[model samples]
Target: MGVKKTVFKTFKFILKNRLLFFLILLILLGALSYYYSENYYLHEEDPSSENFLLNYPDGHVVSLEGWVVDVYPGGFKLYIYHHGKDTIFDVRSNTNVSVGDNVFVKGNLDDEKIITAKKVVLKQYWMYIFLLARSALAILIVIILLLRYWKFHLENWEIVRRK
Candidate 1:
């Protein structure tokens, strides 16, 4: 048999086994969703600041606990100990904190020693909708492919038996 025909025959055989095909499809979809969700959560962006730290290349999320250094009208600057490096964060002045108060700030670490605050909490909510949409589309495509394979196998089987 030619290579094309041999490949098609093998594909037919695999599709005829419905349980095996579905099981493989499920595993693949699950793996894709896991990967997407992990990456989505790991790279969330904070939208509170005009200068989003996550927008910077190689920027990372960090938590800094330190005393407020200077409070300005627009924003306040915080001197924080971040990963053994002293860093400054331009925080919104409206934030409920005093200059001498020790506070914990959670945001992205920028190259210019700035942290753009997304939220005070450790968890971020920006990427949740994106991750959900991606995962749903992936699952839908897998299901459609599985259904198409089943239909193709049924049609081919009927033709072979008619001979």
Candidate 2:
């Protein structure tokens, strides 16, 4: 009888603290997801993993996506983001690019750890900023439309469709 009473009290407390209960549930779910998530990138020694450039054999065709950290007359130095560390590689491409540009290169890996790019795609810094601005504007528009069509019911403690 005492155990049942304590369980009932605990249940009542949880029901009264809905926000705290939901927050705890969310944290538990996130922990479970992280625990079960794949960590292919974490294994840098694996040849199949894309996180390390050295995993690929020299003269092998490879495709890499990274940012240009320095630009030279012939090419630029690429900095690949791999698990909080930078994997820098030299790229030789004729495509005009600049430092801070996001680039995708498909090329052969040379013995000197250089990529002789067969094809190069560049995304300028201004284009990335414009993309962020457009995304924020779209989100703002969505929130405005949602509030216009719905309202919170204080008595019920929930959002209801406005008529």
Candidate 3:
């Protein structure tokens, strides 16, 4: 009886706050995706003309730079070309790499000669830097907005006039 009433009350409260729950869920999902994309996602990278994968055997750390020629989505396989040599790079997830985009690949080659990319960074450093700066600015703006939104609610009730 008591437990049932408490459960019903809790359910009703939750139902009344569905919008807040959904907002939290949306924020969580966005944060998770950003975390994965920034830290876990293997982005393709291209550097200078030096071959970072030269003479590297299996299980050895190989770093290479080349243009992304093809990408097989959902398979984590990317076909990159360096000096006319086709190199197979395996990413962790579906990497957004376009053809002719310069990228740097760092990983170890398995027994099958496929480069398992641990970190695939793009050659364009300035672009990523710009993006990071923009993200910081946006975060600052959100913080300011939240501060302003809550600032008006705080009150000091210490002042009083007596006759």
Among these predicted structures, which one has the highest TM-score? 2
Candidate 3, lDDT over the whole model: 0.61
lDDT by residue (7-68, candidate 2, tens digit) is 99998898789898898899999988886556644543323215334465778667778889
TM-score of 2: 0.63
Using all chains and alpha carbons, the TM-scores for the candidates as numbered come to 0.33, 0.63, 0.35
> Residue by residue across 61-114, what tens digits does model 3's lDDT show?
666665555667642455556556666665543456665556666766665446
Better of 1 and 2 by lDDT: 2
The weakest ten consecutive residues by lDDT in model 2 span: 44-53
lDDT of each model, Cα atoms only? 0.60, 0.79, 0.61
Question: Residue pairs in steric clash, candidate 1?
Answer: none
- Candidate 1 local distance difference test against the native: 0.60
Task: Indicate whether candidate 2 or candidate 3 has the larger TM-score.
Answer: 2
RMSD of each: 13.2, 6.1, 13.9
lDDT of 1 by residue, 1-163 (tens): 6999999988898798877888989999999999986676345443222223333433666554566777777556776663355556676535655556665666666545566665542212234456678899999999887665644346544322221
